[model samples]
Target: MQINREQLFRASCLSLLVTSLSFGIRAGILNKLGVDFQLDKAQLGSITATAFWGFPLAVVFGGFIVDVIGMKRLLVLAFLFHLAGILLTIFAQGFWTLYISTLLVGLANGTVEAACNPLVTSLYTDNKTTKLNHFHLWFPGGIVIGTLIVLLFNKIGLGWQVQVGVMLIPTLIYGYLFSRLDFPVTERVASGVSTGDMYKAILNPLFIFMFICMFGTAITELFTGQWIDVLLKNVTDNALLILTLDTGVMVIGRGFAKPVLKKISPQALLLISAILGAIGIYLLGTLTGNAVFFAAIIFGMGVCFFWPTMLGFVNTNMPETGALGLNLMGGAGMFAVSIYTMFMGSYYDRVVAEAHGNGAFAGQQILHTTLIIPCVLVVAFIGLNIYMKGRAKKSAAAVQV
Candidate 1:
């Protein structure tokens, strides 16, 4: 089939936007839900992290389904899950219901990502990394969109439940577009690759490095994206207003990554991203006044490309692995977040408990705790950068021979 690159790209972006919707809801709307349910930090994290929990399962299974059933079917299922979860969440009375709803939401998200990541690569096989970054720009972009929605609703005195339910509009529209569109063939399909070859490729040192990078990248990016609202609310004077500001800065950073990835190698870009993220997260935890805002912009810049860039790398080097590789990386990343979220969730409650409403300092400590994730990200990038550089040299040398 002839591939219309533009149409496929648009579809990929929309898929990413929809998949990221659950994260937006968790990040921007979850805390308010915490108040609604009278829940604690632990429950908040559990319900919020439920969507990501599907990652491990989805990563292993989502790719197989994508390979067997196709992207179109997987995407349709994802949209259904997203729509159902959002509607269920609207009327959820207590912690258990919300938890189950979020888990369903997570399943939809996992399926969407499983379907779309390989679709983007198949669309622009010539420029896998660049296209992948362009594809993933929507995730942060969705956060910006979702943040604006939340801010607009708050300004108008709308209920959080209505704001949550309003996501149904885009959910339906994107699903419709996905239904009409014919998805491109997978890299594995196009190459006519065998499963044994793909699985063996997964064991390659470079492949393993990319896999681990996904885990660290997920932890770094999701940790901030998921918790920043609460982190900002705790430290800043105008809590709700800061979400817009932070997400806005994050959007700008993500949008710029397309150009930035072109100018610098992904490895270099990642290292720079790590340094910026580390500084930004650390400052967010420790600093005050206008400084915190500046730090947030820096941190957003740090993480802006971590996920997309890493995916780009995997797709470039291991195109034959197809949706399985993408999902494996994505699932690994989310699994890292699930682990970190649980820790941070418990840790956040502990810090809040210690302070007992005393003020900004308590918030500062929680914000500081977030630094651990970014710090780990910095190290993760350093390791991945070294491996990528070595691999690049090996590829170039092989070509020379």
Candidate 2:
């Protein structure tokens, strides 16, 4: 069977677009769900948590079995889950329905990533990092599209249900595109890497170390994004624009990632990103009104290299771990985001109670505390940068000997 790599890649991007659009749709609809369903803050958070938590369940499971099940079957699952999730959410009557719908969307999202990440690595073996960056730009790209959809809907007096229903368009498009193409064997499989070797590679002390780092990196990016609409609403009328502008910056930065990699090592990029992240978060918390846009740009740039570069570094550095390792990294990140989603919700409610229901104060207070995560990451990345460089030198020296 002949594979049209470009068509497959486009399908993969649209699949991811559906995943990110879910994020945008949920962000835009949180308040609507809260009011229409008569749910409390914690319940809404729990519902949101379902989406986050559902991702890891699919990603970890899908990652483990993707090779055996075949990428095409996994994508078929994504399309079906996506279709069901969108339709169910459109008809959701209460908390349970909304919760289940979000979970389905999340599962679909994870399945898409599970299938596509390995697929891209397989398709572009020579330049995995640069291409991964290209592939991941769709994440922000999709969010931008989703956000616009939300805003456009908001302007026309359409409600959240219709906002969600719009996701079906791209979902169907990708489904059709994928149905027509032939999937290549995963890069790990094609390279003749044994399953045993792939399993062994994940337990490598370095893989474990990076796995821990994945928690910090993923939380820094995903948690902020998940909560952005809530966190900034009180501070800026342009609250949505903060997310829009930041993601727009991310789109531009990721589009040009190839040149960026030529100048900086991934480790160095991670360290720099951590520093920018800390500054960006703090600035967003402290500043108000239009000044928030500046913080948004800095935050966007900070996170630009985070998702792709982390996956690229591990995949390139730890080739033996194969698709399983990539999925684990992705799963770990999503898992962390899920945990924080719950935590942030509880924390917000507590702060509001303590402050006598001051959401603005609660918002700023949480941002202050969240700033610590990225601050700690700054130090962690410095050490990581040093270690990776030294390790590279040792590998070169060993080859010479």
Candidate 3:
């Protein structure tokens, strides 16, 4: 079947919205619960970690199902999980209950990545980098939407349950849209490419760099998204404003990156992004004033293109791998974040307990320390960038000769 651009865009948007809602929940909910529900550091970390627990399974399974079953079915399942999870969280009062609901949410979140990444890449076969970035904007955009709702709920003095429940509206809408849609067949089906060839391509150095970029991007972006409110609370009088500023700047940075990627080399873009990320994390950790907020804007400018750009790069450069590549990207990225977030959460828990006895620095500070994951990864990206560019040039020279 011929892919319709509008349908693809709509599907992509819905998929991203699903991802955004699931991933964004922890960020907005964590700080509020501390003040309202009286949750402590470890419990709060568990809340985020619970949702992330699906990452390993999602990355592993999401790709297989997409390759085996199809994108539409996976999406339907994802939204169902999301819908049920949100409903459960809306009513959950106890710790175990919250854990169950968030885990469901994480499952649905992984499903979104599973379905949408392939959908978008399949739709825009040529301009994979530009188009994939377009696809992922909704992830962050959903965070913006989720963040706003969280703030509004706080202003009206609503309960946490209501905030969780409200996500059901979007969940249902996206679910309904996906249900009626037709799915694209696996690229392997379309191209008659064998599975062995796809695996061989994925194992290549370039694809490995693709995985590395996703791993770094997930940790850096999520560390900030999940904990920025808590971080801002520590350093600023107006925590909400700071949180808003951080996300707002990120949104703006994504906007700027769309045009820049169109004009520059992906290698050049990655280099600039790494530098911006290092500076952004440093500022976030060390600076406390309005100045730090501005620094966040700069950081957002750096990292905005990282995720989609990497996906797009892989899709563009490795077209023969088909939907398998997108799934691998999602799987690798989510799996990386899952492992890293858990490690950071455990480490931060121990550090906070030792240094401050649960009172000195909040979970936010410890979480922010997770920024080191990406900081180190960003430096590595520089090396990856050099290797990729050199590889691409060599490939081109070989073709010419």
Model 3 lDDT per residue over 110-181, tens place: 778777777776666666677777677777777777777777887899866776776777788888877776
Candidates in order, TM-scores: namely 0.93, 0.98, 0.90
lDDT tens per residue, model 2, 1-401:
89898888888988998998998778877877888999877888899889888888998899899989899999999999999999999999898998999899989989998999999999998899998999899888877777888889999999988888889999999999888899999999999999999999999988998898888888988788768888888888777768888888888988998999999998899999999989999998999888899999999999888999999999999988888999899999998888888888999999999999888898898888889988999998899888988998999999999
lDDT for predicted candidate 2 compared with the true structure: 0.89
Model 3 worst lDDT window (10 residues): 358-367
lDDT (10s digit) by residue, model 1, range 163-268: 7887788788888887777677787888888888887777777778778767666776777767777766756765544544655666676666667766888778
lDDT: the better of candidates 1 and 2: 2
In model 1, residue pairs whose N, Cα or C atoms come closer than 3 Å (at least 3 residues apart or on different chains), thus clashing, are 51-106
Better of 1 and 3 by lDDT: 1
Tell me the lDDT of model 3 at 307: 77
Error of 2 at 329 (Å): 0.6
Candidate 2: regions farther than 4 A off: none
Candidate 1 least-lDDT 10 residues:
238-247
Which should have the higher lDDT, number 2 or number 3?
Answer: 2
